[model samples]
Target: MSSDRLALITTDPAVLSGQAVIAGTRVPVSVVLDCLAAGMSPEEIVAEYLTLTSEGVQAAAVRGAAGP
Candidate 1:
């Protein structure tokens, strides 16, 4: 993953049972990916998940596209 991707997402056992979440927020990366898949724009995702910024959502999308 790119540094921007790494910086935008974080996984910690204490947080959401270690789900890869948007950095500093409980909103999981999967949620962002799912939102995008469901046709929600980055702005829409940010509206739904207030803690997430457009950049973070974009980063998550990029990572999801890149895959494991």
Candidate 2:
């Protein structure tokens, strides 16, 4: 995949006041990461947040694992 496709992180002033979020949603990347860390499955997350996908959840996990 291109880096852009793999990069789930994004920011836009018109979106969620520019918070870093998964591609197309107001859901902060950290919120997804926290849910995953709490042992919530991707399906569960999707069920709870329709804007999220399994890929998004996984990407959040990968990014979270890669600390700054």
Index of the highest-lDDT prediction: 1
**Model 1 clash tally, residue pairs:** 0
Local distance difference test scores for all models = 0.87, 0.79
Please give the distance, in angstroms, between residue 19's alpha carbon in candidate 2 and its true position after superposition: 2.1
Q: For residues 1-68, write the lDDT of model 1, one tens digit per residue.
A: 46766678888999999988888789989999999999999999999999999888988987797784
The candidate scoring highest on TM-score is: 1
Looking at model 1, residue 11 earns an lDDT score of 88
Clashing pairs in 2: none
In model 1, which runs have C-alpha deviations exceeding 4 angstroms?
Answer: none
Q: In candidate 2, how many Å is residue 65 off?
A: 1.4
